[model samples]
Target chain A: MKLSDIFKKKNSGDVAKDRLKMVLVSDRSSCSPEIMDRIKNDIIEVLSKYAEIDQDGLDIKITEMETDDKGTKSVPALYANIPIRNMHHTAK
Target chain B: MGEVIVITSGKGGVGKTTTTANVGTGLSMLNKKVVLVDTDIGLRNLDVVLGLENRIVYNLVDIVEGNCKLKQAMIKNKDNDNLYLIAAAQQRDKTSVTPEQMKKLTQELKAEFDYVIIDCPAGIEQGFKNAIAGADRAIIVTTPEVSAVRDADRIIGLLEADEMKQTQLVVNRLRPDMVKRGDMMSADDVVDVLRVDLLGIVPDDEDVVVATNRGEPLVGDSKSLAGQAYMNVCRRITGEQVPFLDLEAKKGLFGTIASVFKKK
Candidate 1:
């Protein structure tokens, strides 16, 4: 931890807002953790046919993202970060 | 026909009953004929909050079961000539009243009163379902706390799923001092996170407890800040454009200066 962090605590209101933002994303999507797991497995199965994926480095979550440049509206978006090791060369 | 509005919060102890009592009383004070309905059933408290507990000869369950007429179950407010209350049955559970019954009851009440305000119980269960079954719109109440705001978000999703699209929010028990100190979320913060139109904000005041203890609504007090806030909410409900209370004004000179600087 930084020395300044020890002396200055984070504002609790900001903390609450941050927490609610993350929590509401999944809540608004109505996607349970189990459903998310199933979705991740399905995506991995599809992607594995095309590339060698680093499964251990995969991360996926539902979050809110701005839909416009003005930031006036936001919508729940699914974000997935998957590490690729190699691509499969297929011949028909 | 009158409008049916349900006052609800998914979590308990966020002042759903108090808001119902005060808003109902405030609407009646505006010369609108209003009736408050407590749909909590077994754990009912709206009647007590309105100070009409002793006058309840019948209740919602009794009326639905045909044991009493709708008029027999409605207890008039002691102070307001236009206000009345339909108390929930203390002995019955949430399952005792079905959504169909509540819808019919609200329809009948709508024909008679200018406003029928329902005090919905906490939790997204049968009680919540029954409360919003017949309502034309909803007023969701939440505090600045994380738990309350979280529950309010969940309720908004549920309400939207049910196609009850006309929903407004009221942030209750807001401590402006804490917000100024950056320790508590402001009403604007909550509205931003919840993504709903803000109806009003009620400051945390001791007068609320005093008024509740006396079996009187704070809106009748006239001197209380929370009472004035609730009155403004009632006026807004009637399509009146009212400015929100300047909560920072209640702070001393030092706070006013701090707020001014913060705005810049």
Candidate 2:
């Protein structure tokens, strides 16, 4: 009801759509938060051996991505954002 | 033989039984001999929904256990001669019937009826397994809620894993006004998230509850929007191309004003 809130409020339908998209990713992958955490840690450990990685900035998730030109087809895709500060010169 | 279609939703209270009754009745109305089998077992409801509760002399378990013949178990609908219902045994649990027995029963029903519509119980348990055992296709019903859609996604995955690939989605209890106000998910939103072919969408109509209480499906009412939606779904099931209902256009005076504003 406030003047400032009128322009900034997001529609509930859009909010629901976003939430469903996020929840269904994990639901479809059958991956729990615990399992995702473990996967994230394992990936971090493997990458850290050869490169200096930012553990705090690392982002990973399973999301649905378009598979076709028309965007008619989609499939679950695992995306990872690993920020590396520097690479080790010597092979481990 | 006839096609055995299972009407299911992994989550409860999403109108699976109501859809089964209406679709089966609508198919029968279309002159197709239809028999609705209630596979929910302990929570038998199709009989009550169809107003054939008092006529049950024999049930599904009785026929499976050799206590009675199939003909004796099927209760004729009061409304249509072509429509019949095989009531589930109320006292017995879902464990009473195995998937093999369910398949055999549907096979037998398929020979006699044009469509054998099985109303599946909620959840991904033994009850769910028995219902889909003999289905040639599936109609997964879900509301425009987060929990229902999530459960529907799970049901779709399970059906695909079981190799029942000919599955469709029915988004029930949709509210057009709410969707217009950006307060509820539209049928398209549900289909987009579920990634399934949309069969039809039933708007959230109060007449559905009235029809359920009277043990008569709204599909035959002709006046109820939800009934028309169900009829359209049945038509699509039979491979007929029917346009989806224009729910927004039916919104009376307020809708007219909204349309005028949009044009300007």
Candidate 3:
């Protein structure tokens, strides 16, 4: 059998095998989930100073979608979306 | 003319002494002039492992304190003519000898032997510093567990801080059955996480326990698989291309077949 085929058979259903994938991804991206959360919070605070953004509508989450490498497991992607509905509000 | 290599693990019972004993024995078997130094201070056991505990007249502290010469403290291994051991002082504390003292002692040993392997005491304390002080390289031994790996990481960081150029790893006590069942981490997994050059991987063989109980190093046992792994590590230290043992193939017919071409 081919090497890739053998690797596929060996890696299937083994969640622990994702350790190297997760660790390398985090290391290469230079951002862990905790760091991403902290950055998200900082962004929210900074944007809050200029405009009023709805915390409830602000969808800040990380989604790991595989870009390429069809057979191999991919890293979780970080996603962020902020909505400023009451931007014209004045501080009283 | 020889290199001083320190075998260390931050936590106790991770097989630092056993590795030292086996590697020393293996190197000696290869006819290399090897000297194993027990730097555990108050907790000496390398001499016992080498079955030379009774022959140690002068310990490390005595030699360092000028009670005896360095040559007087070195007890020759009866089994292997080229192997020598410097036993630790079970009564003296680690503070008895400073890192500078260890450096001086090992410097002298380096001029006499082909390899000087120091069995470092557990923890990243004074004993650890003294053990690795004059070494040209280091081998960090760790098990495939979170706590051991964490401690190994800390030790590696400390070794880097000390500016040691040659630092490799030896992951011991790996259970192949568990690793195959996805219950335990494999040697590759440990290596990937540590991101260090792997010297060798030793399986969790019961022969190791038998060897320890018999007060003999497994590395010299012709039939023991763990013994062979230690030998492979010794060869790798001297720049050999020995492959890592595939623990998963250590059972039944496949094991026998794999063993035929397996790295020594």
With a 3 Å backbone cut-off (N, CA, C), the pairs that clash in candidate 1 are none
For B1-264, candidate 3 gives per-residue lDDT tens digits of: 999999998999999999999999998888899999999999999988877888989999998899998888889888678999999999989999999999999999999999999999999889999999999999999998766776787788789879998889999998776776667777878787766889988888899988888878889565777888899999898898988765566654565676687965
Model 2 lDDT tens row, B14-99: 99999999999999999999999999999999998998989999999999999998999988889689999999999999999999
Could you tell me which 10 consecutive residues in candidate 1 chain B have the lowest summed lDDT? B247-256
TM-score of chain A of each: 0.70, 0.72, 0.43
Task: Kindly state the number of residue pairs that clash in model 1.
Answer: 0
RMSD of each: 5.0, 4.3, 8.8
Stretches of candidate 3 above 4 Å error? A1-44, A47-92, B252-264
Q: Report, for candidate 2, the interface RMSD.
A: 0.5
lDDT of 1 by residue, B62-149 (tens): 9999998888888888967899999999998999999999999999999999999999999999999999999999999999988999
**Candidate 1 - CAPRI tier?**
medium
TM-score of chain B of each: 0.95, 0.95, 0.94
After superposing candidate 2 on the true structure, give the runs of residues whose Cα lies further than 4 Å from its correct spot: A1-8, A38-59, A64-76, A82-92, B252-264
By lDDT, the best candidate is 2
